[model samples]
Target chain A: MTYCVGVSLDAGLVLTSDSRTNAGIDNVSTYSKMYQCETTPDRFLVILSAGNLATTQAVIQQVKRDVHEGKPRNINNMAYLADVADYLGEILVNLIRKHNEQGGFIADATLVLGGQIKGREPNLYMIYPQGNYITSSSETPYLQIGESKYGKPVLDRFITRDASLEDAAICSLISMDSTMKSNASVGPPIEVLIYKRDQFTTPKHYKFDAEDPYLLAIRQEWAHHLNQAFRSMPRLEESQAQPNSYLRAL
Target chain B: MTYCVGVSLDAGLVLTSDSRTNAGIDNVSTYSKMYQCETTPDRFLVILSAGNLATTQAVIQQVKRDVHEGKPRNINNMAYLADVADYLGEILVNLIRKHNEQGGFIADATLVLGGQIKGREPNLYMIYPQGNYITSSSETPYLQIGESKYGKPVLDRFITRDASLEDAAICSLISMDSTMKSNASVGPPIEVLIYKRDQFTTPKHYKFDAEDPYLLAIRQEWAHHLNQAFRSMPRLEESQAQPNSYLRAL
Candidate 1:
């Protein structure tokens, strides 16, 4: 299981992912799920993956190989960000199909692609295992893949197009923290990348292991704040008599 | 789709459920999912249900009929609370099997049963569609059924055997509110029932329609507090340079 989230903001793009991977309880391992490619000085791209480990690794290796081999349709030479998304989608579909024919196992994988070209705006796309992809809109500025439900309410409440890249990254970490607390399959070291629009170079990156002091501080502070917030909310007993009022009227 | 939660506390038990039911998008309707039966003056029971509506309705009707007919092994005649759980489990499994044989449609339902009989402590059980059931523990004093994930985090943080019944009820309401915000399939009028320890007759019940003033007040106040809490948490930029310090040292 994995949890990867990418937010496209007016200031830039923020992407975060958990590093835990497991085939079963006994087969748990940790691996980096964030891939960064400076396809060219003008073109920078990041890929965050979830689902089948073998399939995602193969897809990443193929993408790197295409750039090295100077293939006709590689990320380096793609004309638009959407074209890069389409290229990744094609690679994913072909790999899954090849594996499905070899035996009877699921080879599905999901991915998020976010980056910018020199003259164009930064963009974010979520590529499905079936080789289809959808981009984020102004109304919905973020996209998530894998173990999404536990962390979604916070994003729905706080994420907006106007949020700063730093704020978006903070919200993403909070989201990942909530998921890790609820699910054992998603763990650290957490990887986060923040890209300022049009920079087209390696983005600001940070990794936090399970015992990292800063991560622990954030977790503790968030929990404290949440408990305080809950306590401050109006109590149910204060409102209980309102429902009974109608009964009294009858 | 539905969301129902039951919590067992030192003071008593708290159960909350949403009222929405739907066969398809066009066929949405509202029906109470909370059922209470006082089989005898000393024995009280409450059942909260989710899953296929027809299957749940049939199971509830059968239980009512058995009580009316004075069946030899009915809920009214059960000796222990566990026996009542077993009885409900048996009825659920038999009904699902009978319907599955009629055609090729699923007839699955999940339920949470909570109550107390005189001379026994209050308790809670979750009955699965496969004719098995599990009870809540002191460490984990709550049981949930139907679209449960969205509402789980708060309960994981706040619920304990030491919590007052009113506090448990408030937490349950917050959990249901979170679920309703995240899932359109689980709507309201919401139903909540709070039972005091050793009381065998009617529990305190409250029904909140979508436009209920108290429900709206809680929702608005909770959201405002959450936003404030998020803003108060420490920012990521304050911790950004620590990761770089290690990299520079290396």
Candidate 2:
């Protein structure tokens, strides 16, 4: 399992992903799930992937190969970010289908594609394995894939279109931290990228290993503050008495 | 979908569940998922259920019917909490099997059984639909069923065997609140029960509707505190410059 989040804010976009992959418990390994593609200086794209490791890696290889070989409709030559997303989706679906047909295997992959083209606004899109995609909206400016629920409450509570890039990045980190704490499959080192709108370049990227000082500090501080928050909330008033009958017959 | 949690603490047990049931998006209904039974003063139990509504309701009906008919091995006749868990698990598996065999349909359910029998200490068990069960431990003092991940981080961070019953109850509420916020399928009204050890009677029970004042207040206060907590955390230092290459070729 994996956990990756992409946030589209008024100021920019933020993407974060965990780096753990496992075919099974005994075969676990650490592999970067975030891929950066800059077809041109003005078009920068980051892809966060989850699900079947082989399928994702194959799709990534195909995309890079297409761009390098200057295919007719490659990521490098796409006119719009949405076109790039569509192209990636097509590549993913074809790869999975080919593998399934050849070996009767069921391989699937899901991706979060987010970044900016020279003339377009920064956008975030979740590409399904079935060769379709959905972009984030103003009301819900974030998209998550793989082991998402554990990290989702924080995003539901805190993410907003107007949030500053730095704030969004921090929120993404916290979300990833929550997921890591709850799931053993989602371990560190964690990768975070903050893309400034219209910059059309690689965003500021930070990677934190499990014992990284800053990461540890964030975890400790968040835990402390959370407990304090809970303790400070008003307690339920003690009921005057136990109800005469606690069971209502069905 | 549903979200129910039971916490075992030194003070006693805290169980909380949401009351939303849905066959599909348009077929949602409100149904109480918490059931209490006190066959005798010495043996009291509360069952929190999740999964196929028909299956859970049928299992509950069967248990009640057996007790009413004075079955040789009904809940009333069980001597240990584990025995009761076993009985409930058997009923669940048998009911599911019978329905599947008769109609070629698959219906499943999971339950959390927590309470006390006169001679034994308070206990908590999660009975799977397959007739297997697992209990909480000192290190992990809580068991959750259905839509569990969204609400699990808080429990992992705060719950402990020594937490007071009130604190455990509060934690369970927060856990439920988190689940409700993240998932549309899990909603209110919320039901909470706090059971004190050594007292076989029904625990203090409170139900909070979506519009309930206290529930609203807790939501507001928790949101406020969470924001404050986030703001108080130390911010990551700004990196001096964008790296020449942010991507390392895989």
Q: Using lDDT as the measure, which candidate wins?
A: 2
lDDT of 1 by residue, A1-250 (tens): 9999999999989989999999988899998888886467888788999999999999888888887898898988888999999999999999999999997677899999999988899999999989889999999999999999888878888899999887788888888998898889999999888888978765788898999877898889889988887777677764463343111100
**Looking at model 2, what is the TM-score of chain A?**
0.96
Model 2, span B105-206: residue lDDT tens: 889999999999998899999999999999999999999999999999999998999998888887888888888888999999898888899987757888
Q: Residues A1-250, candidate 2, lDDT per residue (tens digit)?
A: 9999999999999889999999988999999889887568878899999999999988888888887898887887777889988988998999899999998997999999998878788899999999899999999999999999999999998899999887887788889999999999998989888888887755788888999888888888888999889898778897622364565476
TM-score of chain A of each: 0.95, 0.96
| iRMSD of all candidate structures | 5.6, 2.3
TM-score of chain B of each: 0.95, 0.96
Give the clash total for candidate 1: 0
* Alpha-carbon shift of residue A16 in model 1 (angstroms): 0.8
Error of 2 at B232 (Å): 1.8
lDDT at residue A232 of model 2 (Cα atoms): 85
Evaluate every candidate with DockQ and list the scores: 0.38, 0.59
C-alpha positional error of residue B87 in candidate 1 after TM-score superposition, expressed in Å: 1.2
Residue A128 shift from truth in candidate 1, angstroms:
1.1
* After superposition, candidate 2 runs with Cα above 4 Å error: A240-244, B240-244
